[model samples]
Target: MTGLVAAQGRPVGTMGRMASTAPLPLTVGFDLDMTLIDSRSGIAATYRALSAGTGVPIDDALVVTRIGPPLETELAHWFPAEEVPAAADRYRALYPSHAIAPSTALAGARESVAAVRALGGRAIVVTAKHEPSAELHLAHLGIEPDTVIGRLWAEAKGEALREHAAQVYVGDHVGDVRGARAAGAVSVAVTTGPCDAQELREAGADVVLADLTGFPAWLRAFEAARAA
Candidate 1:
């Protein structure tokens, strides 16, 4: 889409630089798991519990390390293809208890959300997590995004981004870069998740940061430059 290249020939990999004439984004989308919350412990715990109950040997480390993909995808990795559906059901059934309390907001999560709101922009979370679970995390963190979309990943997430007219999409996975590109939104990748900066960039991230901590400041600078 035209919006994917809307930055007017600016270098996509550079942070804190936007064209002065570029339009300021009014809607921003965020990924939930690594981008906003540190959920590895909870996710690992749930998988361990599932393994115990089913007598299936699940590698807790592997599960935790692969958090960005949907739970079904993870389940398929651990279970036989034919058994994946039932295993996914059991995982979801046990997820809430193991996940909720252990989850915590990542550094700058609140401030990043605030930065978007401070710009009179709407903040929305688009994630591959189940809707209820994603909502639970947001409620527990006391972060009220304008909307939360769940169970959509990669290009599927682009549909929601387009629906919201999101101008910027921030995430911590390669899938997020694909989603942002699909939606024609600016892709902001953070290295807080399993993927490294180079991996995210290779997946087509327009901008990359060390973590969410740098986002608010970069966003402010972008807006300031736009206004100048």
Candidate 2:
């Protein structure tokens, strides 16, 4: 049996809004970084560029390790409280030129989104990164989700997910679990990012996947059950 269960522990009908009357289109939320885009190298390069331009000492390797949180959160570690705002702005400005080219789409990223559409569902990307920068990355990599929401993270990400009526939220962080929980959506976590499987489970993820490669199978099983 596939372990794709709903929030209340039901194996079938993962969506809280599913109706036995008729099958309706579904919306699935995904995290941008780590889950959809392997932006670690690009992000690191951007940080390095920011450091060079700002004359600040930033550890690109170290920053890339904890990649799920917001940019300002990490900037705080390297910049003074007063300088964080400016540094964040500068980083965002440098990101396009320094980060976009090197960033690559994670394996199965395109197929995962297409899988949603193949089932008459909408795939959306929710992220903490700035909206413009997020759009640039997606444009650069040719990864097109139906909707892309930016500047949201962790529990705060629930705002956009709820608005889109997303029944599932896929991501690579414990914060993402909280976001899905906040929106009453099933949390499907991928192990491609900093968080490990155990950590994701401990954080209350409903499903733990090795990477996006397994998403289509999971989505297939999920829809099959919903239509059952």
Candidate 3:
């Protein structure tokens, strides 16, 4: 069991959900990459570009499959520890060119963010991508979140969620579940990414939905039940 401090002094039990009884605002946090956008093509292209420039052969297909983690982490798998930093820098330099056109918001992504706003809640994005890159994706997709915190993965995401006092965190990766749980927020997993429903369930997601399309109704019902 991974231990994490509760957000805003709220009690977070073993379930990793906030145990507070006070009426809290419906703040929601989201993961970018596979959760909101299909960035595989762009990511793969960038890796290929890096390989071409550095004369290092890279398996773009394998790289694309491991997108949820940080670019450095992925680079480390291929490059030596000493070479990772430079390789990562090269990758970031090549990313924007390859990313812009091919990257697109996944279905129901906008609606999910809109749902949070509609419920008088603030929507934020926490991602492993660089902050500027994450911002570019949001701008390109025309989806607005109250805040975007990038370059944070796993437990590091917990600190940001705590600062925002998020009640719900939605994502498509198991890392997202761990992050949400660490922050004591509801971990809502969507099976639109590489991970299937059962995989997400085993990862300890509180609620597993087919995709973000189901989130609005689920949130509504959850709020109604809480009120009742």
Candidate 4:
């Protein structure tokens, strides 16, 4: 759970279909990469560019498969520990040109966030991605969140979620499940990232959906249950 906090007292992450909530807005936290945006094509392209620039071989295909962790964590697999910082910097530098253009929203991403906003809830993105890169992807696709917090993963994501008063956290990774639970938020896992439904369930996800397409209905049910 490597944490990259945003100064002091910053909020982050959440999800669903639709049902008007209480007068107060509910804050929901989301994982950026596979959860909201499918940046694999762009990420792999960036890695290829980085490998070309550094003359170090990186398995771009394999890299995209594990997209939840920090950039440095992936770089560690290829670069020497001492070289990771420099490599990570280079990757971020290459991301805008190589990654952003090809990046796209996962299924129901826009609707899921919109559903939250429709209910007067705040939709926030908490990701291990570089903040600037995350913003670029969102801007490119026009899938907006109220707030975006970057460089946070696993349980470290809880810090942002807790600060934001998020009651629900949605993502496509087990790390995301851990993050939601760490904040004492309901973990809604989507099988759109690296993890499968069984894997997410085993990780203690409160609910599992095939993709964000199911989120709206699930959210409606969730709101009904809560209101009940």
Best by TM-score: 2
Error at 59, model 4, angstroms: 1.0
Give each model's whole-structure lDDT.
0.90, 0.91, 0.88, 0.89
lDDT per residue as tens, model 2, 1-228: 677886677766545445457655688999989999999999999998988898888999999999989999999999989999999888988888989999999998999999999999999999998989888999998888888899898889999999999989999999999999999998999999999999999999999999999999999999899788
Order by TM-score, highest first? 2, 3, 4, 1
Could you give candidate 4's per-residue lDDT for residues 100-186 as a string of tens digits?
998888999999999888777789999999999899999999988999999998999999999999989999999999999999999
Model 1, runs deviating above 4 Å: 1-25, 225-228
- TM value for model 4: 0.88
How far off is residue 118 in model 3, in Å?
0.6
Q: What TM-score does candidate 3 get on C-alpha atoms?
A: 0.89
Model 4, CA-based lDDT: 0.89
Q: Tell me the TM-score of model 2.
A: 0.90
For model 4, state the Cα shift of residue 161 in Å.
Answer: 0.5
Error of 3 at 220 (Å): 1.2
Best first by lDDT, ranked:
2, 1, 4, 3
Worst 10 residues of 3 by lDDT: 10-19
Q: Which runs in model 3 stand beyond 4 Å of their true positions?
A: 1-22
Error of 1 at 127 (Å): 0.5
Shift in Å, residue 71, candidate 2: 0.5
How close to the true structure is residue 14 of candidate 1, measured as C-alpha lDDT?
38
lDDT string for model 1 (52-153, tens) is: 999999999878887898888888877999999899888888988998899999999999999999998899999999989999989999888999999999
Distance from true location, Cα of 83 in model 4, Å: 0.3
